[model samples]
Target chain A: MDLLRFITAGSVDDGKSTLIGRLLYDSKSILADQLAALEKQSKNKEDGEIDLALLTDGLRAEREQGITIDVAYKYFSTPRRKFIIADAPGHIQYTRNMVTGASNASLIIILVDARNGVVEQTRRHSIIASLLNIPHVVVAINKMDLVDYSQDRYNNIVIDYAEIARTLGLKDVTYLPISALKGDNIVEKSTSIPWYEGPALLELLETVQLEKDIDLERGRLGVQYVIRPQSNDLDLHDYRGYAGKIASGIYRKGDKITVLPAGLTSRIKTIEVGGKEVDEAFAPQSVVVQLEDDIDISRGDLLVNGDHLPQVEQEFEVLLCWMDTKTLAAGNKYLVQLGSRTVRGLVKEIEYKVDVNTLERQPAPAQVGLNDIVKATIRTATPLPFDRYTDLSVGGGVILIDETSYVTVGACMVQ
Target chain B: MSKEHNYQLDYLDQLESEAIHILREVAGQFERPALLFSGGKDSITLVHLALKAFRPGKFPFPLVHIDTGHNFPEALDFRDALADSIGEKLIVRKVEDTIQKRQLTEPGGKFASRNALQTFTLLDTIEEFGFDACIGGARRDEEKARAKERIFSVRDEFGGWDPKRQRPELWNIYNGRIRKGENVRAFPISNWTELDIWNYIRREKIDLPSIYFSHDREVIDFEGQWVAVSPFIRLDATDVVETRRVRYRTVGDMTCTAAVESSASGIDDIIREITATRTSERGETRIDDKVSEAAMEDRKKNGYF
Candidate 1:
């Protein structure tokens, strides 16, 4: 079966959690024991109805506080495809969690309560989907039952979102009207609104196109681990090999490749996946490659096609998403882990912080705190192989870990 | 050499790459790391991936198995054989040793399981070795509370999991840094499901304990599930032992593990059976999980693997 990974982004009252719970419930994915547990924990069910929101709220703190503090991943599959949903908590301060969810998401479901139309939270989520380059956007106009299944309100909200989508450059956006609480137009088409026509929420999810979401034009592999036997015997077939997941593009035997930061060149001699010889290997497959020449290579080294080499530079512009409680100021050193390489880097300047709500650029703030996204330039102690985050999602991403705490303080996208 | 490249990935291949990536990160980041090998399919796959990650060289860390003493003999034998073949250091910490010290008590009466007692031995082993990182083969698809787990899960100095305070893991980067006394439990296969594990095992042709395949085992019908009759189990007078053609959907200590009535005698048959099965892998085999919905969560908080 095919797999689709998506994210659910909305506020507590926007029915984001309820939509996820409904998808699982209607899909027959919720097992008997889990449902029973849900029933047992739900103390204040209205008119003895099961509260679906309790299903996604896995943590005690989340249930007690009635909010999702971090991204909680949920999985379900229909006959056609498997789905991994990054259920990101919806709060202004929790924007980082949404980015975390969107990082790997192919599609993002921005739940807009029909009663409220396209609110600021809707725009904030949209901008994030654009910033992170989530390929498809499903604007589920939820709570249509509360609005008496009015198509005009849904149409107007769709119109409002269309303008924002155009402005934010959201590649693909599909609109659906439904009541997650009542299971309307979620799994099955809603007869209550005969005037509206669109694929059901679940159908859209299963078949949404992510073919072009991850680019594969330029081949790049960051050497994760090298396969070298300390003592070699003829029986061991102990040829020098480099093991890594292909970051982007395709690699085949006999292709001449360049190693970044060191610029060593060699031809691919053989390819092996899980110790079985394969003719070729492509993006994301963990394969071991042996080169024709005995070249010095190690972890933190990049292997790329000579014709499609990535930029090797010491300093560059990056969009930094601050993840730590500690404020990010100018000249604060951090360990930058980009691809397979981790090197010490300092935030040279605070360019500007984006106001996630207004989609406005806040220029040159003195310092930035938790959940802040900024565009800044950083200098590394060692050079790194670079590609713009827009070009290759896998190769261009970096995480900033605090030097003292070793905690990931920022998620940086190369610009 | 000029053949067209294929971007399509066999789903299992994607899972394998992700796992290998996580394993390398563990070896690189941790000062002292150990792979939690139970000789089960998941842990076995972990060792296989570690071989792919740091093969041709000694494993960056040792192999740790918390022996319940109620384990299937086949599992122990396979565990020993696999480690010896792989040339990795294997550390066995037994519950029997912990029980001998009177630090843990063996429960009495029917429904008593040594499964829960393994937690104490695990925490004690972690402390004894001062292992800062423990790599596990836990999959999120196994249990509910685990579904919310991060790839790089941090535990306190006492090895407690704080679900509320877990660091948000994004993209492929895992935050493995922890304080002096704390440790990180890195699950490389957290995204893999039961079917994924079986499919991977089949593709890789990895060896498993014989209990996974259908065999005639003396068992008792306990709580509506067929359970292996082990010496440590307290059987009541009403219980009847019968040899049933059964296979385990999961591998744990024989005391707490249940088997399904199946004739899936090989890896292919097991995969087919799993495709047709509706209940979860853990839901079918692990009776300990049925104590309460959050039993796994509560145990994990108390440092259970």
Candidate 2:
């Protein structure tokens, strides 16, 4: 079965964990032992109700404080598809965590409580999903039970979310009205809302079109590890291979390729999967690419089709999200890790800080602190190969680390 | 749609790419690294990913297995054979050896298991070799604490994991940088679920320990689960041993690893069983996790892989 990776974003009381638990519980994904354990850990035994929030609240602090501070990954499967859920906590200070969780997600579920429609956090999450280029969005209007499963309430909230999604340029938005606590529209259709005719949340998740999300133009492969045989082993004696996952596009043997930053050229002599030789490899396949000529390539080097070369620049602009407690100031040195490459870099300029909820800009911000998303220019000590985030996302994502603390302090999208 | 641009990747391919990328990072980032191989299906899959990451070449890192001295004989045999076949250096640090050095003391009882003591040997071996990175096969779907883990997790000088202080991994760009006296525990297959592993194993045709396949084994019913009677496990007078067609969902030290009643003779059969499995791989097999709800979490925070 194929995989669909999605993220769920909502405020602490939006029932993010409850929604996930309902999906798992209703689908029979939660095992007997797990359910038993959940019962044992239930805080309300007198009511004979199992606390679903305690399932994802694995951390002691999260259980005691009744809030998720970090990204919690969850996995489940139905017959049609397997799922990987990156459940990001929707808090203003934890914006970095949401970005981290949604970075690789193909789809995002922005939960909006029916009791409080069109909240600031909802807009913030939608903006992040759009900025991250998530291919799909689900504006799940949750807690319909409180609204008496009212059709007008659900429709009105969806209309509000639709305007925000359109303004943010979010693609493929789907809306669902559900009561996570009562399992309404979660696994089975809720008869209480007879006006609704959409598929259940589980059905939609299992049948979503996630395959078309990958970009397959301009073959890009960052040389992560240059494989050379230790000895005259088997049939691969003296064989040298450029090993990495195809970032995008399709590549084949005999295709002429260019080595970025070095401006050297070579032909793809062989493509092997470590099991056997193959004629061609496409985007996201981790295969060994052997060149006709022994070119000088190492980790951090990029190999692309000669016809499709990415920008090799020492200075570039990025939409940066500062993730550390330490404020980021201009002229402060840091390390930029982009794909397989890590190079020393410094902030050239801070263009602006974005207020995601209002879509306003704090122009020429003097400094950026924890969870602040800003636009900035950076100059690296050496040239690196990268694409614009819109054209090719896998190659454009970068992370900034502190020089001394060795902490990933920021995430950058090459602009 | 043109086939050229419409080449969609299956979930397995995507997971493979992820695992390969992590293995490459381990090779590119660290000075001294090793893969923690338990000879289980997860570790076996990890070895294959590392092999693909640096094939036609010897792995830059060695295979490090913290032998708990009570491992299944088949697991050790497979581990040694795999290391030899790949021509990679294999390092074995035994809990028994650590016990002899007085660095660890064995628990005494009918229910005593050495599974928890493997951590002491592991930390000692890591310090001895000064390996900056330890690639493991710990998946998040197995337990609760693992669900919130970063792909590249940081450990302190004492080898303790501080979950609250973990470095955030934003995307494919993993920060493998750590200071001296500190190390990183990398989990490439963190996103892969139990079914995903079984499917990938079938796809790749990876050879696993024979214990994973169903066979007649002498097992005793212990607390509603079947525990294989082995030399390492001393049974009580009340324990009754009987032959059963069983297979292990997870392979660890024989003393603590339980088996499930099954007729899954091959990968396809195993996949079907796993597809309909009610309990998780560890939930059904690992006795160590039965100690407490946060057993794995406590062990992980204490530097156990």
Q: Best candidate per DockQ, number? A: 2
Off by over 4 Å in 1: A44-48, A235-238, B1-6, B51-58, B84-88, B127-130, B240-245, B263-278
For all candidates in order, the CA lDDT equals 0.84, 0.87
Query: For model 2, how does the per-residue alpha-carbon lDDT over A103-138 read when each residue is reduced to its tens digit?
Result: 989899888899999999999998899778889998
Question: Which interface RMSD values do the candidates have, in the order shown?
Answer: 2.1, 1.4
DockQ of each: 0.51, 0.71
Segments in model 2 whose C-alpha atoms lie over 4 Å from true places: A45-47, A233-237, A306-308, B1-5
lDDT of 1 by residue, A330-378 (tens): 9999988887689889999888888887778888678788888899998
Q: Tell me the tens digit of each residue's lDDT in model 1 across B33-146.
A: 999999899999999888877766678899999998888899999999998988889999998898887566778766567877887888888889889999999988777678
**Lowest summed lDDT window (length 10), candidate 1 chain B:** B1-10
Error of 1 at A304 (Å): 1.8
* lDDT tens per residue, model 2, B109-209: 76578877877888899989998999999999889899989999999877788889988887678899988788999999999988889988998889999
Q: Candidate 2, after superposition: displacement of residue B6 in Å?
A: 3.9
Candidate 1 residue A251 C-alpha distance from true site, Å = 1.2
CAPRI rating of model 1: medium
Q: Which one is best on TM-score?
A: 2
Stretch of 10 with least lDDT, candidate 2 chain A: A229-238
